[model samples]
Target: AFKLNYSFEGISRTKPEQNLSGSSKKLTKDVLLQKTHEERRKRQEQRLKLQSAELLQSHIRSYIVRKHKKDQERQLFDEIETTAGIQVILSKLLFFYYPKEDRERLLRIAERLLNIQADVIQQINADKSFAWLIKRFLLLCLKNTKDNQDSMVLMKCLYVFTVDAHTFSYLVSKDYYGHLKRLLESSNNYLQETIVLIQKPFKFIHESDYLSNLVLSEFCTNFLIPSLTHNVKHILVPYIRNQRKEFPFEKLIRYLNTGFHFGKSHSLLYCTLELEPDDYEPNSDSIQVLSKLSANLYELKPTCDLTVEDSDDEEEEDPVSTEKRLLLSEYLKILNRSDKVRKWINFFLKHNHDESVLMAFTNLCHNLLLVYKDSMRKYLLLYKFGLSSTYLKRLWAYLNKNNTGQFETKISSFIAWREYHTTLSVFCDMFTFYTETLTDSETSDTSHTFTQNDLLSMSKLLKNVARGLIEVAFPMCRSSSIPSTPEVQHLYRACLNCVRMLYTLDLRKKFCPSGFWTSDKMHIPPDLARKDYLSKKISSFYGARNEEDEHLPPLSTIEQRSLAILEELPFLVNFNTRFLLLRDLCRNSLGEDDYQRLHHDLMHENVVAIRRTHIYEDAFDKISQKS
Candidate 1:
């Protein structure tokens, strides 16, 4: 019985152990599935967050773009409204206002409004009453001013009328000659405004045949010449009566100069003289008037001997005398075909020994020299070539004789500097003519040929001019005591550019020896070279100097100053010369590492690739109208 009970207990224990193993396996599977579900949920939340952030960024960008577009539209609409308001007010003032005083006052307000917004002028069109307003302004210019204030308002209105292209067109199309002639005849505060009106047609004459004919025939013949002769007689009559008042010299001179300038353009001077009837002969009265005026001008004492220094301080320019000279000079430009003008020229030529007459002749010739090509053949016929050449040489001698001195005063220095600059300008124009002639001869068929003697004469003149320029520039560059005012510097720079122009024309080769421009012999003094070298070496060893040092005037050492001068002289150096100069200048300055790196970059870089991207992007621009 005991053996049977032991067997049953062992069987029960085996069954319980098997059940525990099955339950543990089930728990392990459940835990693995729950961990997988948590990871999937987290991934889904991350994707949603990323999408929301992207949407928010897009919304911000769109809002900014819309705001900018709306602002631009608003600004444009505002400009349109403002323009419309201005146009309406101007129209009312011009059309509805009948009283002169009311019209003038309203015009001033309109002008101020126009000034406040420049776009109002630009937006003005001929289709509007602005055209009528322009005509009204021009008619007002004809009437005498009540006061200086009235004259100024009229002048400002005329200027505003001219500022719009369409308004100017309308202003010029009308015939105000009858009115202008009256204004020219009368002495009033409207001289400036009248001159402004007269100049408008002259300015646009080249663009319109009607305008050109009007100026040459109606304006010059009836208004300008008659008025000029009348005013001169008026002034001279007063002088003869021992009521020696200041002649209206400036006014007369301005009128004559304006006419001369207009005539000088398009060979209209000859036309002006020829504008008279086929049987037109100077009346006895005109000849007598011109004769008396010429005699009075010639009798003025010689003032040419005034030294540059003395002239700057002591000799205030005699307006009467200077204007007299200028008037005589202008008469030289008149065609000799007219009996009165011919008599005037011959009278002055006979009295050429008179200091005033000679000065006038010189001044005219100097002006002619600068524009020689333009007036050369005409003047050659007028003076005969040899006489004209002699006049120019005599003028050159006179300029050189007076071109003296170390001036202590600013005014004197400026005066002396200007004279030198004029001398350089005259030569620059001469060289420019020479270059043009050569270029034309090479590029096209031409009848005129430059002789060897002509070339030699020009070369000699250029060298002499260059030497004079060097004399001026070298001292100014070397002297640290010279005032570096902008005007002085500008004159200096202009002089240097003239020299560079000479070099550009290949005239420098004839004058400046090749050895002169060598890098080693750049006109730097030995001490200056040493100082530059020492400064550079010290700078390299001590790292860069303070930023304040950079702002100091670059004209320190001769080499540094020369570099500064060269940098400013864009006219002097062409591309190849500029590159060579830069290379030579920077050669010893760059470090070996920097140089190598730059070289490597330049050699390895693909310029075409870099340029290609920009080229393709720019190839089909939607806004460009160009084919």
Candidate 2:
């Protein structure tokens, strides 16, 4: 059924008219109500749709606000990062040009870039460009004014950070040393402060070959030596003490040799040399380095000339010269620690290149004799015969310079050469007697006892050798001019003792009844004793004998005369006299059974005596001189 609805001012519509009964009327009304309900429900749905639209609009606005805020925040962050980067670049540039003004800011930047406490070294290795920048800034700080605390603080930071061996090379380069020298030279106080700063941290630079070489170059002869001489207590002592940290001695040696071709040697203080045995291996780089260092040290002459003003002058002396700041004696005070003096001498002599250098070194050693006599004597003996008798010649020349001292008598007499030649003649005679005795032994090979001719020959050789040795004694005791000096006296005594040992060896048979001498008496000429000058000198020289020595067994006339002669030449006394005496007795004895003992004795005595007197002699001198 179609239902018709009526509005107040509008027309109502009916789809169709069917029946006008009760059922029709009720159905029409129900349709009208359903239509009304449908309209109201549609309105409610529209209202809900409007509310949903409003909620969505609000959400969109909120999203836009939040996104805008985030964008603004991002923009601000970008600006801050850009400003920081610009600040760093500007600070670096300003510090590079005007370090004293912007030092603090640049230093902070450098610290951040180069000094991350835990990973700083790693960072330095990873960022090459940043490291370069840091390096440039560091140098700027170093080049700043002496009074700038910022520079000092930057240096402290640098020292702390660059101590790492892995990164040290990155912080400094070969060119930096020159900058350091220029910076430090302006003020002595600044120089000392710089040294102090570098000194403590130097211990940590254990590796980095490039840095090692640079450090050595920076502290080369010209720069460090002058500093060292002027400030030994403050500079040199600390540097040497730091050698315990594996300092680059090898590089130091190379630096010393760089200018050696022009006769310009490295100014190496003896204190600076930390030479080890490991530095002296054959055909090694270290050996070459060591040789070079030795040459440099030997040839090094002080650049600053020190003049001695006449005592009569009343003017004040000038400030001490760099060369004269530290004397050779002061150097010796340090070198004496490891017997370095001996090592230095041997090294120079072994690699002999310049005679003038050798002469200078020899002269310096001669001067040491007064203070270090015992050690000097041993050193002299080491070169006495070796190096073509160079040491002997030097010694002789030194002795000839002075006419005073204990050796005045001998030098005045000029009889040492004569006595030496005479002794040589006697030694030849003794050798002839030995050969003759040996010949007789061959003939009487079956006999355990000596023949009459063999014994007579030995006895004659012994007497002649003893007399000749006594003559040699006179000159040796009289030759050294510096008698009051213990060193001169000691050397004189050593030589004289060597002679006495040989003499005693020749006269052993008489002293101990070897039975080689036919009688206890030797036909020593009374005329030999007539020259009482040597005798009285002998007595005065040795001084009064101890009372205990007087109680010994009475000596034969020949023995007494030899003893009297030995007393005048106190320098001739040696502890090895008995060994020498016994060995000679065995060598000349006719008994074949004693040959082995004689050879053994001679070998032992030769080793000990040679060390004292003739070990360093040339082979020809050792063989020909006989003593």
Candidate 3:
């Protein structure tokens, strides 16, 4: 059991086991202190490394951000100095009304600012309050300057912004289009560019709304109607296809379907808003030639003025060379090659032959009709071959023949009829001109007048033109009733006038004393006829020029044929009303005051109708004045 050993100083003596335990406790405490100190030192070193890394990273990040900022600033400064530069320093100084002593410098800077119109606009937008000031300065500079380069630049910039989808509304709100229109009037050459700009915004806005309606109205009346020469299908068709809402295409079609009236209305209706292109009639010599013809037609050569040499020259040269003339078929084939026109035609065919498409084609044909007579030959040939429907008919038959009423076939038929009508009018004009020229031979020397061959050639041309017109007009007449519509009535009236003119010319040729030499009843004296045997032979040849009998029956015989033609034509409901008006005018001509007053009233009414039909006449005048 246990006994304890003790030392004499009242201190207890430790046993061997206790001594060992005390040493062990001291060693354990020392080891624990060492471990804790090591742990604390390692933790301190780790925290210092982490702090240093974080500081270095932050510095690098700050340097990168600053470098990027400096680079951006430098790039912007470079841009500011380039051709499309900002010139912000000059702008700000001008805005603050800096000294008058540096007026020259300021003016130079202002000019630069004006030169870069788009840049100036950007600068203006950057500081909204400065817009008015900048704009005023620009206006003042424009007013004081005569050079148009700056003005054109300004217009170009505005147009550029107007076509941008993001900026269109802002530009419109700022009346950029209005300003462009004003500038356009001042400068006549930018019409095409203006139209392009005007059409660009349409693609983005095709819905029903007030803005869209306004845009449409402006496009139709101001841009479309006024620009007669350009084909708008390219500019408008794509947008129309995309649009969900119905546009005013029907209204436009109805208006264009009507015939053009004469006088100022004709001039206005034919006004082309397109700028003269570089390739357009570059030869100035054509004008001189045309003027010479006009002068010669009005000039009266004295009798016995014809020298033998002059007669020889006239005989050698036909005076009218038909070289370089494109036939209608050739012209149409060339037109068909145009990618845009082909696409439009294909689009129409795919769309089930819409009337608007037909109208567009007719309008194109109408413009072709208005071309100079040399070009008129192209249309004539086109009617003969290109639109003969043989090629198109076969093409349709090969394709879905069930879709017989495709665009090509329909447009060809319409164009054929239109060309025939136009050609008939041309024939009537030529016939009248020849008749008058021949009749004038009695007053002038006969030797200098038109030869029998010339007269025969003219007659033959007229007969051919008449044959085509009748072929087209008769079938159309048979299909429709007489005078079914005003358009049809107008065609009937034109045909009637043509017939009357031809008949009058025929009678004059048969009975006129001037044409006695060519008359069938004239029994030439054998002696004189032998002495002038060459002249007699020429006269007899012309007299025997009855080759047109098969195609064109005699005009007197044409009476029954015309009656048959009229029977098929649409009946004119307003014919009796017009007859009564005419009767009243006839009575008024006999010094009847009441009838004259009534005639005047009717004339005024007719003028009102003309004004209504020609809506652009008044606007055209205003446009002309502005230009």
Q: lDDT of all the models against the reference?
A: 0.44, 0.44, 0.39
- Tens-place lDDT per residue, model 3, 179-235, is 544544555555556545555556554443445544544544444444222233343
| Cα error, candidate 2, residue 375 (Å) | 13
Give the per-residue lDDT digits (tens) of candidate 2, residues 222-271: 35444344444456456545554455454455554453332333344343
Q: Candidate 1, TM-score vs. the true structure? A: 0.29
Score candidate 1 by lDDT: 0.44
- TM-scores for every candidate against the unseen true structure: 0.29, 0.37, 0.27
* Candidate 1, residue 591: how far the Cα is off, in Å: 7.0
Instruction: Give me the runs in candidate 3 sitting further than 4 Å from their true place.
Output: 1-123, 148-348, 366-377, 380-627
**Which run of 10 residues does model 1 get worst, by summed lDDT?**
536-545
Worst 10 residues of 2 by lDDT: 531-540
The sequence of per-residue lDDT tens digits that candidate 1 reaches over residues 260-338 is: 3332121123223323333333332333223222322322323564334563476567777665455544545553345
Ranking by TM-score: 2, 1, 3
Q: In candidate 2, residue 439 scores what lDDT?
A: 34
